[model samples]
Target: MQDNSLPVDIDRRPGATILSPRGDVDMSRAPSFRERVREAQAGRPARLVIDMGAVEYMDSSGLATLVEAMRNARTEGVELVLCALNPRVKAIFEIARLHQFFRIVPTVADAVEA
Candidate 1:
């Protein structure tokens, strides 16, 4: 198994690709997170969903990484969605006003459908 600092599971479906990241996403792990995202985007899926249910903490670096990913997704014409954000991660988004720009869903099913 690959030793990922931030464990991420990529599920590539027909149209939407889901990236599930577990554990805290801080400075030490943002790079790994970003790499995983890049790997997911490399497939050129129609939509990208970030399932944040298992992430309990995320620092600014993590948020910045996500912002960068969002920009990349926009440029690539890939729909970026965030699903199942735990309360802490959701608060971070709200604090950064990122929630206003991101498509956040209550569940993975909703993200895939969206």
Candidate 2:
């Protein structure tokens, strides 16, 4: 667990860093999420996996934050993967045509392997 204030749990795997956030990802929480992601990327893991299984909802701000993370990951040469997205959150990315850019998978295990 990185921070108690943020609903994030960070786990370090063999070659990946997994961040699991537990709540809605709206504007109110997007900043914290961004900070958490940034911190995870700071470690320079071969892969960064965001487990969205607990996230039920996400707004544009949340999506924007993810986009920023994606850009940063590219610059850092870290593979970014998002997994366990609920239908609602997954639909948001699909509707925005972001699914084409993001490596989204159905489970954390899949993301870890990806």
Candidate 3:
């Protein structure tokens, strides 16, 4: 099996914050991911973008974190968008039928605009 454990990177843009997460998001790492996202949401931007293009694996815990992040953003009246999802992560979203819960885009620029 491929080693999927890696750290996720979070960055900022003008109108939105970008989280370029890498590696596997599983039970062991989900809390860290949640903390990172929470930190970003705390900034209270009008929109937040999580770039999943580099993510190689995403399990249920990862999905749950994303869902919670979205909820947090919503409560804060900020738009939470997902962008650049790799095939693996996209598949997980499909499996969970949560592909519609987020505003997904093909690139960071697109997500930032939306």
Candidate 4:
């Protein structure tokens, strides 16, 4: 596992891609997050799962990046799902009513299958 102060690792799986992001995804790091996510999606896998179990903080920029990713995935016909969102992150999505927009799963495996 590649470790960084930002705490995110992306692992590509066959027929599915996993973005295991950890730590805060705020303004300073949001661009990197977006770039990494976009790179992951470039594979055009049938499934794109973002594993957020370790994400402790996410600013609006992060949310926007996620929305953009979902948009790209939709346009590309790739199934995108977010998984293991901590309470704060989940609440952000809930408040934004984004919970209804994307498939939120409890685990990476579930997201992969979804």
lDDT of 3 by residue, 47-82 (tens): 889988877888999999999998898899989999
The lDDT for every candidate, in the order shown, is: 0.90, 0.91, 0.85, 0.86
TM-score of each: 0.94, 0.93, 0.90, 0.90
> What lDDT score goes with residue 92 in model 4?
92
Question: What is the C-alpha lDDT profile of model 1 across 1-114, one tens digit per residue?
Answer: 645489888887889888999999998889999999999988889999999989999989999988998999999999999999888889999999889888899999999997
Q: Which candidate wins on TM-score?
A: 1
- Superior candidate under lDDT, 1 versus 2: 2
RMSD of 2: 3.2
- Give each model's clash number: 0, 0, 0, 0
Per-residue C-alpha lDDT of model 4 across residues 7-98, encoded as one tens digit per residue: 46878778888888777898887888888888888889888889999899887888999999999999999999899999999999988888
**Top lDDT model:** 2
TM-score, cand. 1 vs. native: 0.94
Q: Candidate 2 vs candidate 3: which has greater lDDT?
A: 2
Q: Which consecutive 10 residues in model 1 have the weakest lDDT in total?
A: 1-10
Native RMSD of candidate 1 (Å):
2.3
